[model samples]
Target: MASFLGDHELVKTLLSSGALPNIQNYEGNSPVFASANFSNNKILKLLLDNGGDPNLLLTQEYVYNSPLMIAAINENIEGVRLLLEAGADCNYRNQLGNSARKIGEASLNLELKALLMACDNPT
Candidate 1:
Protein backbone atom coordinates (compact mmCIF):
# COMPACT_ATOMS: atom_id res chain seq x y z
CA MET A 1 0.00 0.00 0.00
CA ALA A 2 2.69 2.44 0.93
CA SER A 3 4.73 1.58 -2.10
CA PHE A 4 1.76 1.82 -4.45
CA LEU A 5 0.72 5.12 -2.97
CA GLY A 6 4.26 6.40 -2.59
CA ASP A 7 3.56 6.98 1.05
CA HIS A 8 6.96 7.27 2.62
CA GLU A 9 5.62 7.81 6.11
CA LEU A 10 3.59 4.63 6.00
CA VAL A 11 6.51 2.80 4.46
CA LYS A 12 8.76 3.93 7.27
CA THR A 13 6.17 2.84 9.79
CA LEU A 14 5.79 -0.57 8.19
CA LEU A 15 9.50 -1.13 7.92
CA SER A 16 9.90 -0.13 11.53
CA SER A 17 7.06 -2.49 12.38
CA GLY A 18 8.88 -5.37 10.71
CA ALA A 19 7.07 -5.54 7.42
CA LEU A 20 8.91 -7.62 4.85
CA PRO A 21 9.86 -5.44 1.89
CA ASN A 22 10.00 -8.46 -0.38
CA ILE A 23 6.33 -9.39 0.03
CA GLN A 24 4.59 -9.61 -3.33
CA ASN A 25 1.09 -9.62 -4.73
CA TYR A 26 -0.53 -12.52 -6.62
CA GLU A 27 0.79 -10.99 -9.80
CA GLY A 28 4.36 -11.20 -8.51
CA ASN A 29 4.61 -7.44 -8.03
CA SER A 30 6.60 -6.80 -4.93
CA PRO A 31 6.52 -3.42 -3.21
CA VAL A 32 9.87 -2.56 -4.68
CA PHE A 33 8.82 -3.79 -8.09
CA ALA A 34 5.59 -1.85 -7.94
CA SER A 35 7.43 1.28 -6.89
CA ALA A 36 9.67 1.07 -9.93
CA ASN A 37 6.73 1.68 -12.25
CA PHE A 38 6.58 5.22 -10.97
CA SER A 39 9.18 7.97 -10.68
CA ASN A 40 9.26 7.69 -6.92
CA ASN A 41 12.92 7.22 -6.36
CA LYS A 42 12.60 7.72 -2.61
CA ILE A 43 10.10 4.90 -2.28
CA LEU A 44 12.21 2.61 -4.39
CA LYS A 45 15.26 3.51 -2.35
CA LEU A 46 13.41 2.88 0.89
CA LEU A 47 12.34 -0.54 -0.31
CA LEU A 48 15.82 -1.41 -1.49
CA ASP A 49 17.37 -0.25 1.76
CA ASN A 50 14.87 -2.39 3.62
CA GLY A 51 16.11 -5.53 1.89
CA GLY A 52 13.90 -5.48 -1.18
CA ASP A 53 15.36 -7.68 -3.89
CA PRO A 54 16.09 -5.42 -6.85
CA ASN A 55 16.43 -8.50 -9.06
CA LEU A 56 13.06 -10.09 -8.29
CA LEU A 57 11.44 -10.56 -11.68
CA LEU A 58 7.71 -10.50 -12.15
CA THR A 59 6.45 -14.03 -12.80
CA GLN A 60 3.16 -12.85 -14.26
CA GLU A 61 2.60 -14.15 -17.77
CA TYR A 62 3.63 -11.57 -20.39
CA VAL A 63 4.80 -9.08 -17.78
CA TYR A 64 8.27 -7.63 -18.07
CA ASN A 65 8.75 -8.61 -14.38
CA SER A 66 12.06 -6.91 -13.78
CA PRO A 67 12.33 -3.74 -11.71
CA LEU A 68 14.92 -2.37 -14.08
CA MET A 69 12.70 -3.20 -17.03
CA ILE A 70 9.70 -1.57 -15.42
CA ALA A 71 11.75 1.52 -14.67
CA ALA A 72 12.84 1.70 -18.28
CA ILE A 73 9.33 1.27 -19.59
CA ASN A 74 8.11 4.01 -17.30
CA GLU A 75 11.03 6.21 -18.39
CA ASN A 76 11.98 6.59 -14.78
CA ILE A 77 15.64 7.35 -15.21
CA GLU A 78 16.24 8.11 -11.56
CA GLY A 79 14.55 4.87 -10.62
CA VAL A 80 16.77 3.00 -13.04
CA ARG A 81 19.85 4.72 -11.66
CA LEU A 82 18.84 3.88 -8.11
CA LEU A 83 18.30 0.21 -8.94
CA LEU A 84 21.59 -0.02 -10.80
CA GLU A 85 23.54 1.73 -8.06
CA ALA A 86 21.94 -0.62 -5.56
CA GLY A 87 23.28 -3.58 -7.54
CA ALA A 88 20.40 -4.54 -9.79
CA ASP A 89 21.51 -6.86 -12.59
CA CYS A 90 21.44 -4.50 -15.57
CA ASN A 91 21.91 -7.49 -17.85
CA TYR A 92 18.94 -9.35 -16.43
CA ARG A 93 16.45 -10.42 -19.08
CA ASN A 94 12.70 -10.23 -18.68
CA GLN A 95 9.98 -12.70 -19.72
CA LEU A 96 10.61 -11.77 -23.35
CA GLY A 97 14.37 -12.10 -22.86
CA ASN A 98 14.79 -8.33 -23.13
CA SER A 99 17.40 -6.79 -20.92
CA ALA A 100 17.11 -3.34 -19.34
CA ARG A 101 19.08 -1.97 -22.26
CA LYS A 102 16.60 -3.37 -24.72
CA ILE A 103 13.70 -2.08 -22.72
CA GLY A 104 15.31 1.38 -22.48
CA GLU A 105 15.94 1.32 -26.20
CA ALA A 106 12.28 0.66 -26.80
CA SER A 107 11.43 3.60 -24.56
CA LEU A 108 13.26 5.84 -27.05
CA ASN A 109 14.88 7.81 -24.27
CA LEU A 110 18.38 8.38 -25.56
CA GLU A 111 19.59 9.39 -22.10
CA LEU A 112 18.25 6.16 -20.65
CA LYS A 113 19.80 4.17 -23.48
CA ALA A 114 23.11 5.88 -22.86
CA LEU A 115 22.91 5.16 -19.16
CA LEU A 116 22.29 1.47 -19.77
CA MET A 117 24.99 1.35 -22.38
CA ALA A 118 27.43 2.90 -19.97
CA CYS A 119 26.39 0.40 -17.35
CA ASP A 120 26.86 -2.51 -19.73
CA ASN A 121 30.36 -1.33 -20.49
CA PRO A 122 31.43 0.89 -17.65
CA THR A 123 34.73 2.67 -18.24
Candidate 2:
Protein backbone atom coordinates (compact mmCIF):
# COMPACT_ATOMS: atom_id res chain seq x y z
CA MET A 1 0.00 0.00 0.00
CA ALA A 2 2.38 2.69 1.22
CA SER A 3 5.17 1.25 -0.86
CA PHE A 4 3.30 2.00 -4.09
CA LEU A 5 2.22 5.47 -3.06
CA GLY A 6 5.53 7.29 -3.53
CA ASP A 7 4.96 9.07 -0.28
CA HIS A 8 8.50 9.71 0.71
CA GLU A 9 7.65 11.94 3.66
CA LEU A 10 5.16 9.46 5.02
CA VAL A 11 7.64 6.69 4.67
CA LYS A 12 10.22 8.71 6.47
CA THR A 13 7.82 9.51 9.26
CA LEU A 14 6.90 5.86 9.55
CA LEU A 15 10.51 4.90 9.79
CA SER A 16 11.07 7.54 12.40
CA SER A 17 8.21 5.99 14.26
CA GLY A 18 10.15 2.74 14.20
CA ALA A 19 8.42 0.93 11.40
CA LEU A 20 10.55 -1.91 10.23
CA PRO A 21 11.82 -1.20 6.77
CA ASN A 22 12.35 -4.89 6.18
CA ILE A 23 8.93 -6.13 7.18
CA GLN A 24 7.54 -8.53 4.64
CA ASN A 25 3.98 -8.33 3.45
CA TYR A 26 1.49 -11.20 3.41
CA GLU A 27 3.10 -12.55 0.29
CA GLY A 28 6.56 -12.48 1.92
CA ASN A 29 7.76 -9.41 0.07
CA SER A 30 9.45 -6.50 1.81
CA PRO A 31 8.69 -2.89 1.00
CA VAL A 32 12.05 -2.46 -0.64
CA PHE A 33 11.52 -5.52 -2.83
CA ALA A 34 8.02 -4.34 -3.65
CA SER A 35 9.35 -0.96 -4.67
CA ALA A 36 11.90 -2.61 -6.91
CA ASN A 37 9.37 -5.00 -8.41
CA PHE A 38 6.97 -2.18 -9.14
CA SER A 39 9.70 -0.06 -10.74
CA ASN A 40 8.97 2.77 -8.35
CA ASN A 41 12.24 4.62 -8.47
CA LYS A 42 11.31 7.23 -5.92
CA ILE A 43 9.97 4.70 -3.48
CA LEU A 44 12.96 2.51 -4.06
CA LYS A 45 15.28 5.41 -3.44
CA LEU A 46 13.41 6.40 -0.33
CA LEU A 47 13.58 2.87 0.99
CA LEU A 48 17.27 2.56 0.30
CA ASP A 49 18.08 5.95 1.70
CA ASN A 50 16.12 5.19 4.83
CA GLY A 51 18.15 2.11 5.71
CA GLY A 52 16.47 -0.55 3.64
CA ASP A 53 18.89 -3.40 3.27
CA PRO A 54 19.99 -3.72 -0.32
CA ASN A 55 21.20 -7.25 0.30
CA LEU A 56 17.95 -8.46 1.81
CA LEU A 57 16.97 -11.63 -0.04
CA LEU A 58 13.40 -12.42 -0.93
CA THR A 59 12.07 -15.53 0.75
CA GLN A 60 8.75 -15.74 -1.05
CA GLU A 61 7.59 -18.07 -3.79
CA TYR A 62 9.54 -15.96 -6.27
CA VAL A 63 12.48 -17.49 -4.41
CA TYR A 64 15.61 -16.42 -6.22
CA ASN A 65 15.58 -12.74 -7.04
CA SER A 66 17.32 -9.98 -5.13
CA PRO A 67 16.23 -6.35 -5.39
CA LEU A 68 19.01 -5.69 -7.86
CA MET A 69 18.03 -8.68 -9.94
CA ILE A 70 14.37 -7.65 -9.91
CA ALA A 71 15.17 -4.08 -10.89
CA ALA A 72 17.40 -5.31 -13.68
CA ILE A 73 14.85 -7.85 -14.84
CA ASN A 74 12.18 -5.14 -14.91
CA GLU A 75 14.47 -2.79 -16.83
CA ASN A 76 14.33 -0.14 -14.15
CA ILE A 77 17.59 1.59 -14.86
CA GLU A 78 17.30 4.22 -12.15
CA GLY A 79 16.41 1.59 -9.61
CA VAL A 80 19.45 -0.41 -10.64
CA ARG A 81 21.66 2.63 -10.32
CA LEU A 82 20.29 3.44 -6.92
CA LEU A 83 20.82 -0.10 -5.70
CA LEU A 84 24.30 -0.19 -7.09
CA GLU A 85 25.18 3.13 -5.53
CA ALA A 86 23.84 1.83 -2.26
CA GLY A 87 26.41 -0.96 -2.32
CA ALA A 88 24.35 -3.83 -3.64
CA ASP A 89 26.44 -6.72 -4.83
CA CYS A 90 26.76 -6.25 -8.55
CA ASN A 91 27.90 -9.85 -8.89
CA TYR A 92 25.19 -11.28 -6.67
CA ARG A 93 23.50 -14.21 -8.37
CA ASN A 94 20.24 -15.88 -7.70
CA GLN A 95 19.33 -19.56 -7.94
CA LEU A 96 19.29 -19.25 -11.73
CA GLY A 97 22.92 -18.19 -11.67
CA ASN A 98 21.99 -14.80 -13.06
CA SER A 99 23.65 -11.61 -11.87
CA ALA A 100 22.21 -8.17 -12.46
CA ARG A 101 24.21 -7.84 -15.63
CA LYS A 102 22.97 -11.15 -16.99
CA ILE A 103 19.42 -10.28 -16.03
CA GLY A 104 19.76 -6.95 -17.78
CA GLU A 105 21.17 -8.66 -20.82
CA ALA A 106 18.41 -11.25 -20.86
CA SER A 107 15.87 -8.47 -20.55
CA LEU A 108 17.62 -6.51 -23.30
CA ASN A 109 17.95 -3.47 -21.07
CA LEU A 110 21.14 -2.01 -22.40
CA GLU A 111 21.17 0.92 -20.05
CA LEU A 112 21.03 -1.28 -16.96
CA LYS A 113 23.51 -3.70 -18.47
CA ALA A 114 25.92 -0.89 -19.04
CA LEU A 115 25.40 0.44 -15.56
CA LEU A 116 26.02 -2.96 -14.02
CA MET A 117 29.14 -3.40 -16.08
CA ALA A 118 30.38 0.02 -15.07
CA CYS A 119 29.79 -0.77 -11.42
CA ASP A 120 31.56 -4.05 -11.82
CA ASN A 121 34.56 -2.27 -13.27
CA PRO A 122 34.58 0.92 -11.14
CA THR A 123 38.16 1.79 -12.08
Candidate 3:
Protein backbone atom coordinates (compact mmCIF):
# COMPACT_ATOMS: atom_id res chain seq x y z
CA MET A 1 0.00 0.00 0.00
CA ALA A 2 2.55 2.53 1.09
CA SER A 3 4.95 1.37 -1.57
CA PHE A 4 2.27 1.71 -4.23
CA LEU A 5 1.47 5.20 -3.03
CA GLY A 6 5.10 6.29 -3.24
CA ASP A 7 5.08 7.16 0.44
CA HIS A 8 8.76 7.06 1.11
CA GLU A 9 8.46 8.04 4.76
CA LEU A 10 5.81 5.44 5.44
CA VAL A 11 7.80 2.75 3.67
CA LYS A 12 10.93 3.72 5.56
CA THR A 13 9.14 3.61 8.87
CA LEU A 14 7.60 0.28 7.99
CA LEU A 15 10.98 -1.13 7.10
CA SER A 16 12.43 0.25 10.29
CA SER A 17 9.54 -1.38 12.13
CA GLY A 18 10.60 -4.74 10.69
CA ALA A 19 8.50 -4.76 7.57
CA LEU A 20 9.58 -7.32 5.00
CA PRO A 21 10.27 -5.48 1.80
CA ASN A 22 10.29 -8.66 -0.25
CA ILE A 23 6.99 -10.08 1.00
CA GLN A 24 4.95 -10.95 -2.06
CA ASN A 25 1.19 -10.86 -2.02
CA TYR A 26 -1.14 -13.53 -3.42
CA GLU A 27 -0.28 -12.20 -6.87
CA GLY A 28 3.45 -12.62 -6.26
CA ASN A 29 4.00 -8.89 -6.20
CA SER A 30 6.24 -7.37 -3.54
CA PRO A 31 6.83 -3.81 -2.42
CA VAL A 32 9.68 -3.55 -4.89
CA PHE A 33 7.36 -4.76 -7.61
CA ALA A 34 4.73 -2.25 -6.63
CA SER A 35 7.26 0.57 -6.53
CA ALA A 36 8.58 -0.36 -9.92
CA ASN A 37 5.12 -0.72 -11.45
CA PHE A 38 4.14 2.61 -10.04
CA SER A 39 7.42 4.13 -11.20
CA ASN A 40 8.22 5.34 -7.73
CA ASN A 41 11.97 5.23 -7.71
CA LYS A 42 12.23 6.57 -4.16
CA ILE A 43 10.09 3.79 -2.79
CA LEU A 44 11.94 1.27 -4.92
CA LYS A 45 15.22 2.52 -3.51
CA LEU A 46 13.89 2.33 0.02
CA LEU A 47 12.83 -1.26 -0.53
CA LEU A 48 16.09 -2.21 -2.24
CA ASP A 49 18.14 -0.49 0.45
CA ASN A 50 16.23 -2.57 2.98
CA GLY A 51 16.91 -5.87 1.17
CA GLY A 52 14.40 -5.92 -1.66
CA ASP A 53 15.24 -8.23 -4.54
CA PRO A 54 15.43 -6.40 -7.83
CA ASN A 55 15.19 -9.62 -9.79
CA LEU A 56 12.14 -10.97 -7.99
CA LEU A 57 9.73 -12.61 -10.49
CA LEU A 58 5.97 -12.74 -10.57
CA THR A 59 4.86 -16.29 -9.99
CA GLN A 60 1.37 -16.19 -11.48
CA GLU A 61 -0.10 -14.67 -14.63
CA TYR A 62 0.88 -11.04 -14.51
CA VAL A 63 1.45 -8.85 -17.52
CA TYR A 64 4.60 -7.51 -15.91
CA ASN A 65 7.73 -9.54 -15.48
CA SER A 66 10.54 -8.52 -13.13
CA PRO A 67 11.18 -5.05 -11.81
CA LEU A 68 13.62 -4.52 -14.66
CA MET A 69 10.93 -5.47 -17.17
CA ILE A 70 8.33 -3.20 -15.61
CA ALA A 71 10.79 -0.33 -15.43
CA ALA A 72 11.94 -0.94 -18.96
CA ILE A 73 8.44 -1.39 -20.32
CA ASN A 74 7.34 1.79 -18.63
CA GLU A 75 10.42 3.61 -19.90
CA ASN A 76 11.42 4.42 -16.36
CA ILE A 77 15.07 5.23 -16.81
CA GLU A 78 16.02 5.67 -13.18
CA GLY A 79 14.18 2.56 -12.08
CA VAL A 80 15.95 0.55 -14.75
CA ARG A 81 19.27 2.05 -13.71
CA LEU A 82 18.74 1.22 -10.03
CA LEU A 83 17.53 -2.29 -10.76
CA LEU A 84 20.48 -2.95 -13.04
CA GLU A 85 22.83 -1.61 -10.41
CA ALA A 86 21.26 -4.03 -7.93
CA GLY A 87 22.10 -6.90 -10.31
CA ALA A 88 18.78 -7.18 -12.10
CA ASP A 89 19.05 -9.64 -14.96
CA CYS A 90 18.28 -7.64 -18.08
CA ASN A 91 17.83 -10.88 -19.94
CA TYR A 92 15.26 -12.31 -17.54
CA ARG A 93 12.33 -13.82 -19.44
CA ASN A 94 9.03 -14.46 -17.78
CA GLN A 95 6.70 -17.33 -18.56
CA LEU A 96 5.27 -15.21 -21.37
CA GLY A 97 8.71 -14.82 -22.95
CA ASN A 98 8.96 -11.21 -21.89
CA SER A 99 12.34 -9.62 -21.18
CA ALA A 100 13.38 -6.07 -20.46
CA ARG A 101 15.24 -5.72 -23.71
CA LYS A 102 12.38 -7.27 -25.66
CA ILE A 103 9.79 -4.87 -24.33
CA GLY A 104 12.20 -1.99 -24.52
CA GLU A 105 12.72 -2.66 -28.19
CA ALA A 106 9.01 -2.89 -28.72
CA SER A 107 8.51 0.50 -27.10
CA LEU A 108 8.97 3.75 -29.01
CA ASN A 109 11.71 5.11 -26.82
CA LEU A 110 14.99 4.51 -28.61
CA GLU A 111 17.01 5.90 -25.73
CA LEU A 112 15.49 3.40 -23.32
CA LYS A 113 16.07 0.62 -25.82
CA ALA A 114 19.67 1.69 -26.10
CA LEU A 115 20.11 1.64 -22.35
CA LEU A 116 18.67 -1.84 -22.19
CA MET A 117 21.10 -2.97 -24.85
CA ALA A 118 23.99 -1.20 -23.12
CA CYS A 119 23.27 -3.19 -19.97
CA ASP A 120 22.77 -6.42 -21.93
CA ASN A 121 25.53 -8.03 -19.92
CA PRO A 122 24.37 -6.99 -16.50
CA THR A 123 26.68 -7.63 -13.57
Candidate 4:
Protein backbone atom coordinates (compact mmCIF):
# COMPACT_ATOMS: atom_id res chain seq x y z
CA MET A 1 0.00 0.00 0.00
CA ALA A 2 1.19 3.46 -0.84
CA SER A 3 0.13 4.82 2.51
CA PHE A 4 2.12 2.22 4.43
CA LEU A 5 5.12 2.93 2.27
CA GLY A 6 4.73 6.71 2.42
CA ASP A 7 4.70 6.81 -1.34
CA HIS A 8 3.01 10.06 -2.10
CA GLU A 9 3.49 9.79 -5.84
CA LEU A 10 2.05 6.31 -5.98
CA VAL A 11 -0.93 7.41 -3.95
CA LYS A 12 -1.52 10.33 -6.25
CA THR A 13 -1.27 8.07 -9.26
CA LEU A 14 -3.75 5.62 -7.79
CA LEU A 15 -6.22 8.34 -6.93
CA SER A 16 -5.90 9.82 -10.38
CA SER A 17 -6.52 6.37 -11.76
CA GLY A 18 -9.80 6.21 -9.88
CA ALA A 19 -8.77 4.16 -6.91
CA LEU A 20 -11.12 4.75 -4.04
CA PRO A 21 -9.66 6.82 -1.27
CA ASN A 22 -11.68 4.85 1.27
CA ILE A 23 -10.93 1.38 -0.03
CA GLN A 24 -10.10 -1.01 2.75
CA ASN A 25 -7.57 -3.80 2.89
CA TYR A 26 -8.36 -7.31 4.08
CA GLU A 27 -7.89 -6.11 7.63
CA GLY A 28 -10.52 -3.43 7.08
CA ASN A 29 -7.93 -0.67 7.19
CA SER A 30 -8.30 2.16 4.75
CA PRO A 31 -5.52 4.18 3.12
CA VAL A 32 -6.15 7.01 5.54
CA PHE A 33 -5.82 4.60 8.43
CA ALA A 34 -2.58 3.22 7.07
CA SER A 35 -1.20 6.71 6.53
CA ALA A 36 -2.04 7.73 10.05
CA ASN A 37 -0.66 4.56 11.59
CA PHE A 38 2.62 5.12 9.78
CA SER A 39 2.64 8.87 10.45
CA ASN A 40 2.41 9.67 6.78
CA ASN A 41 0.80 13.07 7.07
CA LYS A 42 1.15 13.97 3.40
CA ILE A 43 -0.59 10.82 2.27
CA LEU A 44 -3.21 11.23 4.96
CA LYS A 45 -3.92 14.73 3.69
CA LEU A 46 -4.07 13.44 0.13
CA LEU A 47 -6.67 10.86 1.13
CA LEU A 48 -8.64 13.36 3.17
CA ASP A 49 -8.57 15.92 0.39
CA ASN A 50 -9.95 13.24 -1.87
CA GLY A 51 -12.88 12.45 0.42
CA GLY A 52 -11.33 10.16 2.97
CA ASP A 53 -13.20 10.18 6.27
CA PRO A 54 -10.96 11.23 9.15
CA ASN A 55 -13.41 9.68 11.60
CA LEU A 56 -14.05 6.48 9.73
CA LEU A 57 -13.97 3.52 12.10
CA LEU A 58 -12.75 0.10 11.09
CA THR A 59 -14.90 -2.89 12.00
CA GLN A 60 -12.05 -4.84 13.49
CA GLU A 61 -12.47 -7.10 16.51
CA TYR A 62 -10.67 -5.09 19.21
CA VAL A 63 -8.72 -2.34 17.52
CA TYR A 64 -9.80 1.27 17.76
CA ASN A 65 -8.85 2.24 14.21
CA SER A 66 -9.91 5.75 13.48
CA PRO A 67 -7.31 8.06 11.91
CA LEU A 68 -7.06 10.25 15.00
CA MET A 69 -6.85 7.23 17.26
CA ILE A 70 -4.10 5.67 15.19
CA ALA A 71 -2.08 8.89 15.06
CA ALA A 72 -2.48 9.57 18.75
CA ILE A 73 -1.59 6.05 19.78
CA ASN A 74 1.52 6.21 17.62
CA GLU A 75 2.57 9.58 19.02
CA ASN A 76 2.50 11.06 15.54
CA ILE A 77 2.19 14.78 16.00
CA GLU A 78 1.86 15.80 12.37
CA GLY A 79 -0.68 13.09 11.66
CA VAL A 80 -2.68 14.13 14.68
CA ARG A 81 -2.57 17.79 13.65
CA LEU A 82 -3.75 17.07 10.13
CA LEU A 83 -6.57 14.85 11.30
CA LEU A 84 -7.68 17.36 13.88
CA GLU A 85 -7.62 20.17 11.34
CA ALA A 86 -9.69 17.95 9.07
CA GLY A 87 -12.35 17.78 11.80
CA ALA A 88 -11.59 14.43 13.37
CA ASP A 89 -13.53 13.83 16.57
CA CYS A 90 -10.97 13.89 19.38
CA ASN A 91 -13.59 12.59 21.81
CA TYR A 92 -14.63 9.60 19.73
CA ARG A 93 -14.15 6.38 21.66
CA ASN A 94 -13.38 3.03 20.18
CA GLN A 95 -14.46 -0.43 21.28
CA LEU A 96 -12.29 -0.02 24.38
CA GLY A 97 -13.92 3.33 25.09
CA ASN A 98 -10.55 4.98 24.61
CA SER A 99 -10.44 8.32 22.90
CA ALA A 100 -7.34 9.86 21.29
CA ARG A 101 -6.73 11.81 24.45
CA LYS A 102 -6.90 8.71 26.62
CA ILE A 103 -4.55 6.81 24.38
CA GLY A 104 -2.07 9.66 24.38
CA GLU A 105 -2.20 9.91 28.13
CA ALA A 106 -1.80 6.17 28.57
CA SER A 107 1.23 6.30 26.29
CA LEU A 108 2.63 9.17 28.36
CA ASN A 109 2.74 11.44 25.36
CA LEU A 110 1.84 14.54 27.31
CA GLU A 111 2.24 16.85 24.34
CA LEU A 112 -0.03 14.70 22.24
CA LYS A 113 -2.55 14.51 25.05
CA ALA A 114 -2.51 18.25 25.38
CA LEU A 115 -2.83 18.69 21.65
CA LEU A 116 -5.82 16.39 21.50
CA MET A 117 -7.48 18.25 24.35
CA ALA A 118 -6.89 21.57 22.68
CA CYS A 119 -8.26 20.33 19.38
CA ASP A 120 -11.29 18.87 21.12
CA ASN A 121 -12.29 22.27 22.48
CA PRO A 122 -10.76 24.80 20.11
CA THR A 123 -11.98 28.39 20.56
Better of 2 and 4 by TM-score: 4
Candidate 2's clash total is 0
TM-score of 3: 0.90
lDDT, candidate 3, 22-43, per-residue tens: 9988988888888888889999
Query: Which parts of model 1 have CA positions greater than 4 angstroms off?
Result: 62-64, 121-123
Candidate models: Cα lDDT each:
0.83, 0.78, 0.85, 0.84
- How do all models score by TM-score? 0.89, 0.85, 0.90, 0.88
**In model 1, what are the clashing residue pairs, if there are any?**
58-65
Clash-forming residue pairs, model 4: none
lDDT of 2 by residue, 3-36 (tens): 8676777777888898888887777778888888
**C-alpha lDDT of candidate 4 relative to the true structure:** 0.84
Give the per-residue Cα lDDT of candidate 1 at 109: 83
Each model's RMSD to truth, in Å? Answer: 2.3, 2.6, 2.0, 2.3
lDDT of 3: 0.85
Clashing pairs in 2: none
Q: Which candidate ranks first by lDDT, i.e. highest?
A: 3
How do all the candidates rank in terms of TM-score, highest first? 3, 1, 4, 2
Q: Residue 24 error for model 4, in Å?
A: 0.9
Question: Which one wins by lDDT: 1 or 3?
Answer: 3
**Candidate 4 residue-wise lDDT, 18-93, digit = tens:** 9999888777888888899888888999999998889887766756568898888789999998888888988787
